[model samples]
Target: MSSATAPHRVSDAPSLVVSLENSPEAAAAARDVAGDFLKGLGPPPGRDASDAVVLIVSELVTNAVRHSRTRACTLSLAAGPGTVTVSVADASPRPPCERNPDVRGAGGGFGWPMVRRLAVSTSVETSSQGKTVSAVVAREGGPSV
Candidate 1:
């Protein structure tokens, strides 16, 4: 039972936190944790919001694993009425950049933009030790494609 496999659920708050190793597998693990939390939210927000939130979680965790210079990272999810806030924290203060997309899709400059487009709001907080990227996604309709 490691941090990666067992996520920490906050009893006082509508949120969940998961510790992750900075590897490709981090994204999958994050999605699982996010899905579990979303499933408990009930009918109001419905499936679309949950799917979008999970995707956002996947993208953020993937970015941290791929770009951050750390052994591990943390994924946090906080749910609101019709929205969820997804945050990924790693031991790097550098914020993510939105790169030019590769039309041929050989290179990946897509995830960041897609994240921006999907979230109701997005932000990055940096500290001397690390940085956290957060996004708010709505349960119903979100950003325009």
Candidate 2:
């Protein structure tokens, strides 16, 4: 690939970033922000999509609290032309992992799967200081206003 033929990327997404204390109350607050962000999306006519966004918020926040030992975490929301992105960052150096289910198991190990189903794309990135889990979901055919 040459410079002249390189792909172009747009950098116009609107974003909100928040640093939250690592506590159960903070987690609940993060979910509320995420839910509000989703509700504030241009398409306001459908309640179902907003509900799905709330579900995503719950899973992501829960995972951060359960697996991380960070004193604080950051929640970021970015809105694009057709999609919304949610990212949660924690100070834990450990990457998020999924648990293998046992046939006899009836609980646990279901958060990641539920996130995958709700979001169009989900990813985890780790740095020397911490980790960030990001998920993107499309808001297609939603409210026009």
Candidate 3:
């Protein structure tokens, strides 16, 4: 997947804005971007929080690539005093739904539910063009449930 990370202003806190191609690889790319962005923040968001952010990024991007039916998507990450916000925008107007996890692990569904468990808050905005899913995670880390 083609990806580009825009330059961020360090003075305002670490942030990342990236465009991703609608492909399976985009999920991994999103994780990589999150890693680099978090790394650039110096002290890091703690191991647990960092991992959760990356996982959230991967799930959101994967859901967009797998279900959005769009040719491209954008991911934005911003870290504040004690929280991080991850947002993914795709070309599909439909919002995401949480399905019962597949017991066989065939990958039919699972991402959204995990996101909800990990994130402090989650929201979706839809329009004629597409939809944007945003999740906020506490940088201090907490129980996934």
The number of clashing residue pairs in each candidate reads 0, 1, 0
What is candidate 2's CA lDDT for residue 36? 61
Pitting candidate 1 against candidate 3, the one with the higher lDDT is: 3
Tens-place lDDT per residue, model 3, 1-145, is: 3434232222333777878887778888888878888887766788888898999999999899888888889889998888889999998999999888898988667789888888899999999989999999888784442
Give, for candidate 1, the lowest lDDT window spanning 10 residues: 4-13
Per-residue alpha-carbon lDDT of candidate 2 for residues 1-145, written as tens digits (9 for 90 to 100): 3333221222222667776666667656766676666666676414555655566766777777777976767777787777777788888978667787444767578778777777778898999988889877766522232
C-alpha RMSD (angstroms) for model 2: 11.2
lDDT tens string, model 1, 35-145? Answer: 878777755455677778889999998899888968888898887877788999999999999889999979898999988888989999999989999999887757541
Q: Give every collision pair in model 2.
A: 43-143
Q: Where does candidate 2 stray beyond 4 Å? A: 1-13, 101-107, 141-145
Model 2 whole-model lDDT (C-alpha atoms): 0.68
lDDT of 1 at 10: 43
In Å, residue 113's CA in model 1 sits off its true spot by: 0.6
Sort the predicted structures by lDDT, highest score first: 3, 1, 2
Alpha-carbon error at 9 in model 1, in Å? Answer: 5.1
Alpha carbon lDDT of residue 118, candidate 2? 73
TM-score of 1: 0.87
